[model samples]
Target: MFQKVEYSGTKAQQYETLLFQVKALTDGEPNLIANLANASSLLNQFLNDINWVGFYLKDGDKDELVLGPFHGLPACVRIPFHKGVCGKAANTKTTQRIANVHEFPGHIACDAASNSEIVIPLISNGELIGVLDIDSPKFERFDDEDQHFLEKLVNILENTIN
Candidate 1:
């Protein structure tokens, strides 16, 4: 069982706590879907000013990302590689931290209320597994610190999911 997250610490400390919580939540779980579901749920509970948190898994033998477990309103079902923010991150295998979704070309409007976004590519053993995506209602909601911590979170997921 997961405990309520306490946001009473420095940003880095909070993320460190979140990282451990995620590790604890998914530890020994061999089911990928269950891990992803709980991972999204954890992010939804720990983060603030965010409207969406989810995963976009790479379809086997395909160049598109299929939606996976998520905690938010309905989202775009399929995102081709190199298409949107998620796709861009998938293609580059790098984190995309957009301050303004409206200004990003080819940005998919899954939720009109989402003003900023972050997408982290999940890589394990040099293979692209998927992406961890989050959206916020405020512009410039994500920054370098967020990117760093999320990358760490993704690292934990990669080690445990498979």
Candidate 2:
């Protein structure tokens, strides 16, 4: 049984709380997939306004991102390096936060409802491994606070997933 975890605070505060929950959930877990699943679930539950919250795992050859754990509508299963937002983050090994999806170059409209997005690359052993992708229907939904919190959350994910 999946119990809904309620967050009580401003959007940023709620996300922070969720991040901590995810960190705690993944801490000391030896299995990478279980950690990723919990991380994805936390993101999907806490980020109420988001349309997508998930991960794209590095492929067998380490050249591309293949769909992994996620909680939302269906997403792209495979993304080539530098192809779209998720790909760009993986290719560059950096985070990309776009206020408006329409303004981004080469944006892939997996769900036309997504107006904003944030993609954080996951690195392990100094090599690009995957990306945590979040999308929202509201423009400019994610701010600097969100960036920081997500980065911290990704750090936890990096340590656990690897």
Which regions in candidate 1 have their CA more than 4 angstroms from the true location?
Answer: 1-3
TM-score of each: 0.95, 0.92
Worst lDDT window (10 residues) for model 1? Answer: 1-10
lDDT by residue (tens digit), candidate 1, 43-159: 999899999999999999799999999999999999999798999999999899999999999999999999999999988788888999999999999989999999999888898
Which one is best on TM-score?
1
State the lDDT of candidate 2 residue by residue for 1-162, as single tens digits.
658877797867887788778877887897878888888887887776898888899997867899999987898888988688898898889899999999998888899999999999989999877889999999999899899999989898888754
Model 2: lDDT of residue 65: 93
What C-alpha lDDT does candidate 2 achieve relative to the native structure? 0.87
The TM-score, computed over Cα atoms with residue i paired to residue i, of candidate 2 is: 0.92
